[model samples]
Target: MDVKEGNELKEFNMLYKEVDELYHRIALEIGLSDSAFFILYSIVEFGDGCLQKDIADHYFISRKTINSSIKNLESNGLIELKKGKRRDMHIYLTQAGQKFVEEKMMPVFELENGVFEEFTGEECRQLIQLTKKYVMLCREKIKETYHLSSEDL
Candidate 1:
């Protein structure tokens, strides 16, 4: 690749690492395990009563892992599980959980919003679109190399 493309690729890798580190650091600052923080963050972003399976699917994580996180969150009075319309469990944040999100996690959301505010609306939209396209390209490459489909995954 040319120099410009190579620099962009390097910056992308660095951004990924920096974001991951920041996520972990935020979890620590909020006194939550990384998994618990992620679970909470997902619920907050997606809304309450989200399905356990949905979360597992969203993260491409095993049900057992999500289940463990759910249990831990419930034990800490951060979340509650209720029977859904089907046999699935619907997860919701408790009053304490809401408080925790407001106190500990909202700052992170605000910070992200503040950063986004630095860019124009169109720039942000284009960035998201391009990133999603890049992700799909990588996924397709992985599937092709592995001879696997989404169903297999």
Candidate 2:
């Protein structure tokens, strides 16, 4: 879709709706909630040295939300957390977590390729750059709204 008729906020919502649906569908297929699966998938992809706060920072999710999701992932034996030097906690994926992520993401990538493979290499690179740009924009907006900086997160 060209998205010729909508404002930035509208385009944002449109993208979010599709993204949410895909995530929810995939999560349901894997017997997990969309949010939990995303959190776990992220931890697995990024490896365990990621601080608990960094997950929230990277994802633009609230610390409290990530905390609860991490707890659930931990209780399921899918992940573990180790206390760091200060108040920080490091996250690591378990054996089950690794296998689960690999199995679930293979089809997800196939779906992505089927849908987006038409884009040229330049276009693909542009999309990645745009995603990074939006992430930074979101970080600034979040800092404005929540009074929390990435430095402290």
Best by lDDT: 1
The CA lDDT at 65 in model 2 is: 83
Model 1, global lDDT: 0.88
For model 1, the superposed segments whose C-alpha errors exceed 4 Å read 1-8
**TM-score, structure 1 vs. true:** 0.87
Residues 1-153, candidate 2: write the lDDT tens digits: 664665987877789899889888888998887667767767655765688787777777788888898889889987888999889898887888777767875567687788678899899999989889987988899899999978954
Write candidate 1's Cα lDDT for 23-107 as tens digits. Answer: 9999998888777787898898889998888877887767888889889889999999999786888899999999999999899
Q: Over 4 Å off in model 2, which ranges?
A: 1-12, 109-117, 128-153
TM-score between candidate 2 and the true structure: 0.70
Worst 10 residues of 2 by lDDT: 40-49
| The best candidate in terms of TM-score | 1
